[model samples]
Target: MHRSVTAGAAAAALLALSACSSSGSSGSSGSSSPAASASASSAVTGTVTVFAAASLKNTFTQIGKMFEDAHPGTKVVFNFGGSDTLAASIVNGAPADVFASASLATMRTVTDKGDAAGTPTVFVGNGLEIAVQPGNPLHITELQGLANPSVKVVLCAKTVPCGAAAQTALAAGNVTVTPVSYEQDVTATLTEVGLGEADAGLVYQTDVKGAAGKVDGVNFPEAACAINKYPIVTLAHPSR
Candidate 1:
């Protein structure tokens, strides 16, 4: 996974999460001196509202809890949904301290509208997976398998990161698929397959992993062609 936090947006980034350590943290002298660390830690307070993509729900929730435990007076609130929807919300004057998107393209939407502060950092790289029922009743193996008319395939809408990646992977595989329904986010698509509402759904590997027991993941080679780079940024206006 590709991960990086922008130094310029360090404060807001830290507000969103402080449980993680930098790669150099193992060294004697890290980026920040002990004195600076103490001072910064003391100053971190209040609620920091973060707009994040749905795919980050599991990991981000764990990190948010860790951050709150580290800082007594601080709270990290998250609004998880489609990256495009979150970007649109930020650009439309939503009150958010940070924006964590599932795709660079979606993050660009916020940055282009001047809703982001400093520069956006690439936080992770995600690939696609086909989420199927635990027993694999359909016996699906690849992307093209979803092309069968009898398969109830669910896909993310073209506007969302997962959906866009699915489209790219499908095109790369030269497979034509008409999904039974288009969901708004990867989590939603995965939910459809997990609940047995759909035969299979195209979603992020992370989503499938998060729903491990409930759904089985089928990895396809074409996924490499549509890997999504997640981006995070501190919003310009953060309402407490």
Candidate 2:
């Protein structure tokens, strides 16, 4: 009778231990399922591409860095060039999230094609400047100085924003300058001046600001009459 009683207690103890182990395993499995689901849901990280005007390269780069710091999981990619070219590329279905142009004319090209998300906002304004090599070796003093037959001048192509602004200023002053080269973008024009390939080049004041010690900026009165405003827009159907 004592042996039977001891056997019955041992069987009951074994059943309790098995039940406890099954319950603990079930609880752990249930907890790990939610963790796996959360990880799957939170895995979203990629790059946002932006096509901006050449003049905006420096400022936008700084802004991009700040944006990346604010959004740790995302990256910012930039394609900087002439506003007209960027607008044309967006119209042709280039993958870009943001479009920033140096002139309204260029923005219109994108908006007219119904590529822009909304009306663009003017974020900044820039004026034209005559950029010369460090030390102004050519002694260019004013806008009319560019007309000097001996001066080698570089200008932006008329389709570009800087070129349009330069045209307005020159027309306002009634000064005609025959440029040695008409660059496709303001950066190219500035590059020519920085390299001393051209005696002077018309570029945005901001470009000169970037060159800092590499070039000397001469502010002429005509720049006030032809200041260009920069506008930025997000595409309606941006490709990720």
Looking at model 2, how many pairs of residues clash? 0
- Candidate 2: stretches off by over 4 Å: 1-45
Candidate 1, backbone clash total: 0
TM-score of each: 0.86, 0.80
Candidate 1 error regions (>4 Å): 1-42
| Candidate 1: pairs in clash | none
Best-performing candidate as measured by TM-score: 1
Cα error, candidate 1, residue 148 (Å): 1.1
